[model samples]
Target: MRVSVDTDRCCSSGQCVAAVPEVFDQDEDEGLVLLLDAEPPVQRQASVRLAAGICPGRAITIHEE
Candidate 1:
């Protein structure tokens, strides 16, 4: 699974970070979504997907390969 975040569309809600801190974070200064792991392990896929789905700005994207 691959995860990507569009910072431009982020609202700094931190939902992604809250959902999966292992794969996502929020910039302290900019308050934008940060992609910690572009390619997270399979074990983290469910959390990643949840984060993406709950993102208020719809800034998260996921790809499975």
Candidate 2:
């Protein structure tokens, strides 16, 4: 799966980072959601989806390949 984040829409809740640190992170300077892995491994797909769903700002998006 491919993951994306919209910093413009991000509320910096850090929920995505908490759900899947392997695929998401919070920027140190702005505390915005960061896409650590645009394309994460299969083992991390489920958590990636979870992170997208739990994102308060709905900034996380997933495209399955």
Which runs in model 2 stand beyond 4 Å of their true positions?
Answer: none
> lDDT of all predictions, in order shown?
0.91, 0.87
Model 1 per-residue lDDT tens digits across residues 1-65:
88778888999999999999999888999999889899999899998999999999999999888
- Model 1 stretches with alpha carbons more than 4 Å out: none
The collision pairs in model 1 are none
The model with the greatest TM-score is 1
Worst 10 residues of 2 by lDDT: 16-25
Clashes of 1: 0
Q: Which numbered prediction scores highest in lDDT against the true structure? A: 1
TM-score per prediction, in order, is 0.95, 0.93
Roughly what TM-score does model 2 have, to 2 decimal places? 0.93
Let me know the TM-score candidate 1 reaches against the reference structure: 0.95
Clashing pairs in 2: none
